[model samples]
Target: MPTISMTVNGKSVSGEAEGRTLLVSFLREELGLTGTHVGCDTSQCGACIVHVDGQSVKACTMFAAEAEGAQVTTIEGMANPDGSLGVIQQAFQDNHGLQCGFCTPGMVMTAADLLKNNPNPSEKEVREYLEGNLCRCTGYHNIVKSILAAAATMRGEQVAAE
Candidate 1:
């Protein structure tokens, strides 16, 4: 086993892992950040998405060793410093963006990345950007609404009543 270290959730962390250990495993088992789900063993599901050096990546597709010295942000880190829900998260809650909740983490993470790059994404753009993240529940209607509302909120504009 090799010791892998990274800055996770703005904190330093290190743990021993086999070279083949997936980053999601290290984050879940070693660091106990289970918010990053593992709905699929393959990369088809975005359930295990996380931010690696500020870009969203599928954690299950990358090895723990590859994340050495990287800055990783899991779903658990998406909240405010005082632990309140962040803008995107609040939007999800307010908009009923989640049903079973299996895909909410990845959806939120992806939304964060999208909003980072494009602060005010149109409904079509939001839908297009979320193609990689599949949500079996809610039919994606509320999820898209959530992201758009989050974008509006992040831009400091008033969110119209739905």
Candidate 2:
């Protein structure tokens, strides 16, 4: 087992992991962050997405040891310190972007990163950028709308104050 050290959900953590242990497993099993779900074992699904060094990465495709010295942010870390939902998460909830909630965490995290990179994304741009994330619920229309709405809110544009 290789000992890996990294910051997860704003807390520094060190642990021993098998060479083949994926980061998603490390988060869900060892760190008790079950919010990051594994919808598919293959990396094609973005359900296991998380922030690594400020970039969204598929945790299922990365080994825990490979994340040593990096910073990881799971869905559980997206909320405010007081446990209030983050703006992106709020947007998802307000817009009904989630149905089963299995993909919401990853979608919210990816949308947060997307908005951070480009605050005002067009509908086409949002669809294009979110191609990697698959949502079997809500038909993705609401998800796109939620992301755009969140983007507007983040940019201080008037979004009717929902």
Query: Candidate 2's residue-wise lDDT over 51-95, tens digit each?
Result: 999999999999999999999999999998999998889888889
| Native-to-model Cα distance after best TM-score fit, residue 36 in candidate 1, in Å | 0.4
Measured by TM-score, the strongest candidate is 1
The clash numbers for all candidates, in the given order, read 0, 0
- Cα shift from native, residue 11, model 2 (Å): 0.7
Each model's lDDT: 0.94, 0.90
Clashing pairs in 1: none
Model 2 residue 43 CA deviation in Å: 1.0
The TM-score that candidate 2 achieves is 0.96
Model 2 worst lDDT run, 10 consecutive residues: 153-162
Provide the TM-score for each candidate, comma-separated. Answer: 0.98, 0.96
Please list all clashing residue pairs in model 2, or write none if there are none. Answer: none
